[model samples]
Target: MTSEAEGRFHIVDVSSITSGSQRATLRTDDGVRIEAVYEPYTRGVTDTAVVLAHGFTGSADRPSVRRAAKALAEHAAVVTFSFRGHGRSGGRSTVGDREVLDLAAAVRWARERGHARVVTVGFSMGGSIVLRHAALERDTGGHTDAVAAISAPARWYYRGTPSMRRVHWVITHPMGRLVGRYGLGTRIDNRDWDPVPLSPVEAVPMIAPTPLLIVHGDRDPYFPVDHPRMLAAAGECELWLERGMGHAENAVGEELLGRLGDWLTRR
Candidate 1:
């Protein structure tokens, strides 16, 4: 499945790379096409694979997502994918709800490639999706070894920070959705989360027995330290609050990402 528009080429097939990595077009059960890239371990073939989920309005090719994927690839096989509505993928973003299906598809792809251990690592909106996905227990392999969420919100509809308020505005206003669709490459749903999806705090407890690492920054404006604290308490998991970290993928530098990769490998 290949297509071209205005001289640019698009390969929509599940293509294999010479280096053992696989780049594929994965379709979710809900009928969304996801752009996914899998990079096998550069060091050695390890049983563990880290599945990375990006933040809101972000694609797998974003510099921060790529940096984290590259860093984690040193420790284990890495799978990174763009959530629907974010990149070349189809469908509108249900914010964090339907995105879980996207993560589930990526996890299935990792398992299909024979990775025995799948560790999900997510940032911001991705972080919330990972939590809910783990709770839903929909991994194609029947189990996920570990989960790591960075700068995730515990509850929803929080507007304490200016950034979050702006985000809310972007999600609510028609002009904002227009800008999101064109400028950010994000096709977002304008409706509220009807029937209400499980909150991250509510989802955390169900991820127990499966190791969880909740990482946040004390200075994060998007979500205060209390968010991580609430998550830690619910899941009874380990928490790491960085001193001056800002938020999500951009705030997580190489050193911290290396440590996170190390943590995933150790488990």
Candidate 2:
């Protein structure tokens, strides 16, 4: 949060352009322009690519997402982009609904760049969107080799969220109202989408056969450690529950690169 630009964006120049990294604009169907970072030669000679999807209110420039991208780049081409209404991507946010579409576009974009094996990594709400996107794509005949959900709130909000008053957490966060006011998203739309039905619990079933890795911080205040377990149980997914870790603590430290590197390499 060191820098908050007009677009709720920030960037960490971790690598040089000479590193063969390129930044470009990815146009979405809704006309919002998403900022994308492409790091080729990650896998050296693999036809695979990894897409890193940051959580709610997160952008590609966020240190966590950037680091994940760089880490995975060691295994394959890595692409990280911002969700609409977040960062430089178009219009206001649509919660996770339209964000699913954004992931789809990014995947296709990566495929065109020579990625025959596509892997998606989503954190928090980004995980939710990844599940929904992969599900929708499957229903439509598109294919994804693997999809991972990390520390996602895979249950419905507005139900029994005594913790953090999860429903109100979404409804009252100032930024939430701000996005609604700007027509970037809608408050009522959340009511229409049940977390349980739309959550990893529901989405995990469809991802079976395709590889999945569910990572979670055992001490996560927002999502239970068992969350990842449940997500994995639904499909043939591997589970990684970090002891004493909470939420997205995976974004930092040596473990970050090692864990993500291993995951992308497996894909």
lDDT of 2 at 75: 75
lDDT of each: 0.85, 0.68
Candidate 2 local lDDT, 65-180, one digit each (tens): 77777667777788888887677666656567677778877887777667778888888878888787777676442356788777776664523336546535555577656554
The residue-level lDDT of candidate 1 at 72 comes to 90
Alpha carbon lDDT of residue 234, candidate 1?
93
Q: lDDT: which candidate is best?
A: 1
Q: What lDDT tens digits, residue by residue, belong to model 1 across residues 1-267?
A: 343231111223343332555567787878788888888798876888899999999998888887888889989999899998888788889889989888988887788778988999999999998999888874345346889999999999999999999899889999999989988889998778888999999999898788899999888989999999999999668899999999999999889998999998897
Deviation (Å) of 77 in candidate 1: 0.5
Off by over 4 Å in 1: 1-20, 138-142
Best by TM-score: 1
